[model samples]
Target chain A: MMVVIWGVVKFIVLLVLLSVYVLFMTWFDRKVIARMQNRVGPKLIGFHGLWQPLADTIKSFWKEDSIPRGSYRFLFWLAPIIFTTCAFAISFVVPFAPPIKIAGGVLHFSVVNINVAVLFVFAFLGLASFGVLFAGIASGGSKYPYIGSQREGAQMISYEIILALTLLNPILMSQSLNFETIVAAQTHHLWYAFYQPVAFVCYLIAMFAVSAKVPFDLPEAESEICCGYFVEYSGMKMGLFPFAQYIVLLVMSAIMVLMFLGGWTGPFWSGGFIAGFIWYWVKVAFFVFLFTWAWGTLPRYRYDQLMDIGWKILLPISVLNIFWTGFALSAHLPFF
Target chain B: MTQIVFFILSLGTIIGALGTILCKNAYYSAMWMISTFVSMAGLFVMLNAPFVAMLQIIVYAGAIAILILFVMMLMDRRVLNNKERFNPQYFWGIILGVGLFSDLAVLAFKFRINITNAGKSLTLHGSNTKMVGDVLFKHYLFPFEIIAIILLIALIGAIVLTKKDEEEAR
Candidate 1:
């Protein structure tokens, strides 16, 4: 009973922290993108728009929430709920820092430490796309939203293969699915990124594609499809999509740090839990910034082009990388 | 506590399955099917098969359900509304259902004692994923490789069929 209660308390703390982090990322993304475009962003709010996300949250709550008359109202209502739930679910397994010892027991930084953490992330990642697909269909069967959902379905199915295959290289090296074990394997030795650079690069590219970021944002291209899947959504309903997207972005970045960047453990230092926690977020923040930077600089790909790049380029490369990793391990090669 | 969670998940799975059959909209039916898949995954987790549960979610709820929804989305509403009074599939569906039930009944009767022993052995393993890996790669390597080859053949067949359609369109 005590263990269960402690777990609940830990999960609650993680939830609050995740919400605050999402808010900060929203503001950071806008500010960074604005600077890249040579324009000031959200300066009228609190302290160079540090509180912009909070203001936006309040404003969205006050605005009128509308459901299209022709839409499937139940699914319209359920879409964001499911999407947000799946997004937050991925956060449950993320090890924020190394385990810390207190008076008698050890305290883990993650909310829940499951053995199959990597597969758990992949499972929820797939379910999140389901919620987006549902949003497309439930939005009064509109043409643009329908098209957007089609793109999402196809894109997720393709990119997820590469995502799993790329991560398998790291999993092979570490010999464990738990995030902590993966990080522990890299603590003394080199990071898997150094050993499996091909897989690392491919995973980074697939990360953006899986999250539906700028270059692969065909699912919600505002200019082309008029905010695609959530076009009919208004107020907080619309806000929830981007909110969920940001959480997914954070989760993916954290996973990238965990898998490839030697999560929470910097190469230079051997500091304890507090430093590890800070290091984890610092690496995550850099990856988050990369997403926004790409958003500002890159152009969105056409639907066919997006599919071509995923299947033709990323798929073959990921497959070959997996084989190469397997061979290297069996042959007892250096670094691997 | 475990029993309570098991009860809730079982209820969800049954409700979702019924909803999938009864829902008028194809998309809504697909949603119910996905809900059913997820509930079954929860049940699998409770049964100490986290690896299988995750694979179930990733494959069934994630990939296959999305494909089903993708096809359903493009389908005309008129096509979904069947004018016939009878579903021809009901006969075969019932027959197959009864056959499956009888098969389960026979297995239950035959392996009632062995099932308990198997359950105990399952809990003794340190890691379910590693155990499954060993079984697949070492104990059942031939069958596993055969399944993989079959899946690969199906994939190539699908691509070849699709390529022909694209060329004809050109």
Candidate 2:
């Protein structure tokens, strides 16, 4: 009975924590990016701009909700929901920390501890592209939006192949797709990054492209495409797209840390929820910082150049990484 | 709680499937197709086959639907909607679809009635991903290899068909 109550409490707590984290991250990004460009971010709104994200949310809520004439009503309404859902869905299987043992029960770190967590992550990542596709095509015959959605769709599909292939390197090495098991495998063995550096690099590149971050954000080239597929969206509807994007950024970092950088484990890490959670999130934060740094520093890739790298460069490297991992295992190699 | 989830997902799946055919715009139809695929993935999760569910969404909903959406976008949008949503074959199509559904229903009920237990029974024996991989590699290796060979031929055929001759281009 207490366990059931704990489960409910945990779910609510996690949901609230995620939302608060999202809020803080918006502020953090603004501050970081501003410092990068020698300007103040949002310090005027509150102490260290703590309430800026909340204020922005309220402002967006009051903006005019306009739908393009001749727009397909169902799809226009559904796109943001799908996008948000897809972003949050992949986090369901991700274990947050070590399972904490209570008086009568155990508290697992994830919402759903499914056996196929890795596959689940990739699947939802793929599905999320449809939200971009629908948003583009259902925008009442907008030309630029159409172009944007096409690019988003093409880029997602192309990068996904390499993403899955590179993912298999860790999966093949660990011999499990379950995140919990994978983490445990890394707990015993060294971190996957040390063992499979090629896979790590391939995955890192694929991750940027798949998430449509800077240097790979061809779908929404704001200057040329006027923000691409999401041009027609306005108000809080527009708000949801970026919210979903932020959530995905957080989730992707967590996944990267989990798969390659040793999930929830650090030097001399003992079994305690607080310590494990801190280590896990600290690593996740480092990766998120890397993403933002790249976003601030890098220029967007040209269209053909993006596709060329995805297919010609990343594809071959990812495939060879798999083969290398396989050979290493078969030869009973001593080193990582 | 499980029953409620099942009800919602099944309703969504049915509506999505119908919406694909019923929508006037081709873009809407493709979007509905994605909805259907996503709902099917949810059902797969309920059935304890997360691997199959994920694969289903990734391939059908994500990749293929996007390809269709791209094609739909390329064509003139003005002609995508039909003046009359119903076609001459609509009646026959419904009849045939219902007949096929009923036939499958009959077969399933006849064969699997004894195995039926709870109204919402979902069973699983082992690791769904591992089991699938093992079966394909062990039991279905020959058929899988043959299919791979056929896919290779199709790839070659596609290149040959789409190739442009240098003389013709000049």
Candidate 3:
């Protein structure tokens, strides 16, 4: 069937494009961060350090794979494999832009736009925590990684709830779990960010925490835990975590754009497929660039402080934001 | 194509469930259980209930399995030495498991519900999520409220138990 063939082709294309995007992101991130820090990053490999990630990838992938002694062989293998799978799977539902009309047929940019895309997104994001938990626990009984995994588990457990709560803002407004409908809602109304600023702020903080960016990167804090969960890992095994994190960053940025930033819709180019794709790509790029700037600027959060922020602060604000959004909507005010 | 996906997912779930028990190491058992949960989610998705699929993964695999793994992590590694592979109850356990499986198999075939035309039968409005909410809020409202009450009670009980543990630790 044409549908089946198209599905297979789309899967293959998504996989290749995802890898290429992740690889290039390494250089993109380093260069942007370098600019933030007033230094040149990876200029030798190619123009303005474009091919730096390609060189980095080749070196990391070809290096020897070794498992430390006393490691549980099965789990040592399982962690990174599942971690990367979950990370890549999260990108499947992210739409590049709104649907475009081509030859009088509508084309959805997402790989699969399911009925309950919101829940699907939350589920996979939650699943990533298990990979971190197992990776730390299976590190040959290392005390350091065990501690790191515990913190990782605790942080994800706390933040995932807040993230789920914050997601309700757009879900409430659109009353649909489908990403396409949510974007359509945004296109009709103002971006949710302008309407639900409280929820938006809470979600922004939780998003960084979820992706383990700086200020929330305590799980694998290089200075303190000395690589934490992947401390004993080397070569591609070690490099895979960063690769997965890059994918997570992309997914998170894409979701924020879709949910809050009026995905694929900008001025002067409102409704065309290619134009919407371009607009979506531009917004996502801007988000990634902003994230790198934050990564370069912020200090990592202390462990207890991270927990406090997730539970004590963001959790309550997010829960209250739901009520606030509901009240505002009920009032039917100009802002609402 | 649907049959192929269902076959693959069902086989995976069965294999994972068996592996969960067969694997002597606690950590591997937890991993197998998680995989089983994932396969179950795939089955839910195949059934065209995406919300249930998400909950299956999020609640069972993400939360429950992670909790089990946390306990597995704290355990002394030597205690899992698989010295005695089988317990004395093994014979009865197999018999009971087989008995349950056969009963379920018969019931599964007998009670088909034939959900292919259920949506048409109801002629409900809106998306699947909306239909689910409408049914839960209108027809099954009492049971839904009861479930919520039960869950809240369970949560409070857990908090109390943990608070007790803290006091005893102090």
Find the candidate with the highest lDDT and give its number. Answer: 1
Query: Which should have the higher DockQ, number 1 or number 3?
Result: 1
Model 2 per-residue lDDT at A9:
76
Ranking by TM-score: 1, 2, 3
Candidate 3 C-alpha lDDT tens digits along A1-336? 765676577778888988898888888888878888899888987798788888877898888888878888778888888889988778777776677666947666677767788888888887887888888867888877887888788777788888889989999898888888888888877888988888888888988888888879888888898878888787888888888998898888898888998888886667777788888889888878767888889888888888888888888888888888888788986766
**Model 2 bad stretches (over 4 Å):** A1-8, A103-105, A268-271, B1-8, B82-95, B105-123, B166-170
Q: Candidate 3 has which clashing residue pairs, if any?
A: none
Q: What share of the true interface contacts does candidate 3 keep?
A: 0.74
Candidate 2 per-residue C-alpha lDDT over A101-122 given as tens digits, one digit per residue, 9 for 90 to 100: 7786766877777788888888
- What TM-score should be assigned to candidate 3? 0.91
Distance from true location, Cα of A293 in model 1, Å: 1.2
Please say which candidate is ahead in TM-score: 1 or 2: 1
Q: Which pairs of residues clash in candidate 2, taking residues 3 or more apart in a chain or in different chains? A: none
Give one digit per residue, the lDDT tens place, for model 1 in A229-279.
888888998888888899899889999999998988886775777788888
User: How do the predictions measure up, each by TM-score?
Assistant: 0.93, 0.92, 0.91
lDDT of each: 0.87, 0.84, 0.82
Candidate 1's C-alpha lDDT? 0.87
| Listed models, DockQ each | 0.79, 0.75, 0.64
Off by over 4 Å in 1: B81-86, B95-126, B161-170
Q: Candidate 3, A73: how far from true, in Å?
A: 1.9
